[model samples]
Target chain A: MKFSKKDLIKLYTNLVRARTFDMLCTRLLAEGKFVSFYHEGAWGDAAGVGTATFLRKDDILYPHHRAHGFPHMIGKGVDPKYYLAEHCGRATGCCSGVGTVHALFEEYGILGQSAILGAQFTVSVGWGLAAKKNGTGQVVVASFGDGTLARGTWHEGANVAVLWKLPIVYVLENNGIAQYVSLEKAYPLKDMASLAAGYGMPAVVVDGQDIVAVAEAVGEAVKRARQGKGPTFVECKTIRVTSHGYGSPHMVDGEQRDMNMVEELKKREPLSMYEKNLLKQGIITKEDIEEIAKAAKEEAAAAEKFAMESPIQEDASILDQYLYAE
Target chain B: MRLLQYNEAINEALSEELARDEKVFLLGEGVGVSSLATTRGLVQKFGPDRVIDTPIAEAAITGCAIGAATMGYRPIADLMYSDFLYTAADDVLIRAPQWRFLHGGRQSLPIVFIAGSGGYRKVGPEHSHSPHSIMLHHPGLKVVVPSTPYDAKGLLKASIRDDNPVFYMFHKALIGMKEDIPEEEYIIPLGQAKVRREGTDVTVVAASYMNYLAIQAADKLKGEISVEVIDPRTLEPLDLDTILKSVIKTGRVVIVDEDTERCGFAGELMAQIMEHAFDELDAPIKRVCAANYPIPSGFLEKFVLPQPAQILAAIREVVK
Candidate 1:
């Protein structure tokens, strides 16, 4: 529950990095750099980076498409050029620009990122089962949104994970809204933690905006799993300040629809909130935070230049490759 | 040569594969104590480490197999019945097929998906059916339907060794049928067809249990019609070379499929034949397929399924 000076600084650096990366993605999409882009705001940084910091090199992280920040947080030293190239759909990108941004990196432990809801939850079980079967004691984290909680595979996968006592952790990012609809309209339950109780696994509800709180809660879950106990469901009450897809309009066709919660949701920017808390606690100066933000922006610019120059993915042999391991 | 039942031959293949490679393991409901008898005694042979018995979570388990396959483990998922394929279709049909291509060929998914397919012994509408053709609709996954015990052992071995995901179906009615299989280890390469009968009159295409029926029909009308029954054991990467050769020699083709007539594999075969070898055909490619309807309970199931009489009629019509 306590923290070190290095911990807070590391957290701040990752949040800044993620925010800058996300901003560049939005800017490129606006400039028509790519045909499509899924925009997740800066609010997701604390929860994504917080959880990823706890994973060891051997441990696996299976993220949904919305959690691009998780891999960016996994290691700050990753060449942003490869990631930017992937965004531009270039042959120089990791996966030769053929992979979407979600499924980009694997060497950094970003094993997979599925677009389908709750699909990774089930798939991670296999990874966890293998770890246990091999006696490796390695843990695999399965991350998804609150909307995916209603999916049958989530429960189906959780059932086997708990029954077999597999080393898998479920981290649910509860952003309160699925696409356009609010949680109240979709799930009858107020707290998703109770769903874990049904499977007899320990569950916790944490403040997603607080990176310290998320790390502490997920750290315990990771420990318990590594101890050969079972899976843990950690539901973080998070925020999403932008529209579900690329740019906001929340509209169908050409017409704009009603969005009453945007202004209220905008009030709690996680980065700003964390900075205010840090200042109040007398841990850091305003100039220090500014320095972090400046560095992140510079890194983002370098990645952008690299992506612009990268070549688009094209090859005559693409047809024959990737169909089989042979 | 040794006489082993269909399921026993399949069991031998699993045992040998598991022993041959420490990475190969079986996981599914009823695998510890195989309900269909195909996976029976595996847990005893391999122990719990290799033969895993999971709860009835089809979709999730299939996802688990895919993920494990990504991490260099060869997993054989038992679906219990092929009808329950819908429970796991999203991962098997979507993710498993695309993972190889999606990652730019960096990852190879080596997983064998095994299921009991066919309508017999009144397992009812949902349980008693073969959806192999439906599986063919998904690109990049291999489909294997083994009719005889010898092919069952060989193809199962070949599927496990292949780097791609192979969906293998075992005919429920043929599990008890016995055949003389070689004592020495063997693997019939996937995408190879076997000629059950040699004839110049007509080429009868059948698979799994349908091959058995086609052979029976060929025998019943032996003197009058010389029916050449060719079993294209593996659906994808189909041995069109052998099939087209027989088509040119016979100049007539009769396809018998248990799948529904509408949007079925039989229709796909007919189209491919027309596209490649239209000039060799003496008559329109004939088809004896199940009705485009669900298999209801009771004697109606038998009526709805493809029968030898239908194959006989198709042979007679095509030969004329």
Candidate 2:
């Protein structure tokens, strides 16, 4: 699990890309370019980008709205124009404007996201089960927020996965909140890993901020899963750098939780920490770091250009070819 | 071609598809152990991996199937009852139907949702229900309600091969009722209606179990008036050609459905006829549907669903 300079840079760029994507999406939604204001993947980039980097390119991944980074990491067909088309409910979108934020790219095996929480777990398990049955050795990694674990489908999907010994990994991006409610108020059992243990699967809580550490943990889980050792649950104890949705919420938890500590942790951002370590170890120079950020910005800009210039998805044709064959 | 009961046809189709394609697999509550026995021996032949027995999670079962379909597997997820589809409607109504369009057609959701839907079974308020029409409203979804064993087998096989998410509903009562099934494989295409009987007096459009009542009523009124029985094999991509043709020829229509009368299958049929064949009709289209109430339990359950006598009366009214 020793890190390479290329790996660290690649990981950093992914987070950077995710931040840019989220910012753009927020702006787009506000400017009436997109549909909904619900944007994920911004705060929980580690859980998404880290697990994605840990697995092979051919491996299947299931992400939710917040894990939008997974699609961008898998690469190109889902252009920014696709996102724009999706906002307009136009055919040019990845889903031809049918899906909003939860577009799936099958070419990369990035099975789409679910607006309904915990639903992705079921789909991920099924993909893993199919891979296991075929002896493909490919693993399926699914990432969900802490709020989703409260759903019954979480337990049901996990039970089936463990029972069948499916090659799957469940990553819980525990950002300490379920939409509006704090984790403490949402669940009595604080640790989701402990709950995973009940399913007879190995569960671990990791520092989500440490991209390399998160990658190493996921690497072992993916290895075991590939080896037919069954499913594993990795609870990435992470933080939400941005607001829950777009703007500030009026209601605050009455608990005397220290806001000062939260602000202090924000100063110690994961992206900065990774950059500082890479610089000190001589794995990557400040110049290389700057280049990665510049490249990411260009990529985001190109995506935006492509989305804007793409033809508007037709309104009447929305139902065209909707059915596989009429 | 031998007549097969809708339930047995569906079961035979599953058996046949599992034998034909390795990529085809079954999942859901009680499907593997044959809890309902519709998928009785599938697990034995295909083994557990192919014939999966999932925990009681409809949303996951359906959603998981949608996911697996993306990975190039044809998944047939059985919801114990269509009523429970609401629990996992996101997978069925949202995910499966819209997957292809959402993914920019880079993928196809080759998944099937097989469930026993409709009222008249004595299982009470929860179990005895019909919600197929709601799913029928979704344009992308393929809603297949087989009224007989032959159509059940043929259409189920067709659905599995088709590269889309299909909602296949086979009435519970029709499973044990035997009909002649061919030794070789065959397919009943979706969006095509079967003309069970031909007549110029009146056209009777029946869905699922109600087709049997239409047939029975036809048999009793054989000498008095001829009844053209049309079963629109798939609900969403409705076989408008066959139905409109029959309605145009007869100049009268009677739609019989086991579901509630309001916004039921009957209403849909009427709307379709009015849209395409209204001028050809001599009289207003008639409907014989279950009363707008929660399906009851016990012997009265039979009374709640459309019966042969009620269908006959409706036919008489429409023809008169």
Q: Which candidate is the best by TM-score?
A: 1
Model 1 TM-score (2 dp): 0.96
Candidate 1 at residue B112, lDDT?
A: 93
Tens digit per residue, CA lDDT, model 2, B1-320: 66665555677889888988989999888886664678887888888778887778887788778878877899999898888999987778877777776566667788889888766558887887778778876667888888877778888888999888898888876666777888887798888888998888999988777887788888889999998998887887787889888887899999888788898878977887898877898999989888877778877776677777788788888877
Off by over 4 Å in 2: A38-43, A70-92, A248-262, B1-7, B32-36
Per model, how many backbone clashes are there?
0, 14
lDDT tens readout by residue for model 1, B123-190: 68898878888788887899999999999999999999988999999999998999998989999899
Model 1: per-residue Cα lDDT at residue B100: 73
Q: How does model 1 fare in lDDT?
A: 0.83
Each model's TM-score, in the order given? 0.96, 0.92
Off by over 4 Å in 1: A67-80, A251-261, A280-283
What DockQ score does model 2 reach against the true complex?
0.54
lDDT per residue, candidate 2, A79-123, as tens digits? 444655566565567677666666655666676766677777777
Q: How far in Å is the alpha carbon of B43 misplaced in model 2? A: 2.5
Native contact fraction per model: 0.73, 0.58
Docking class of 1: medium
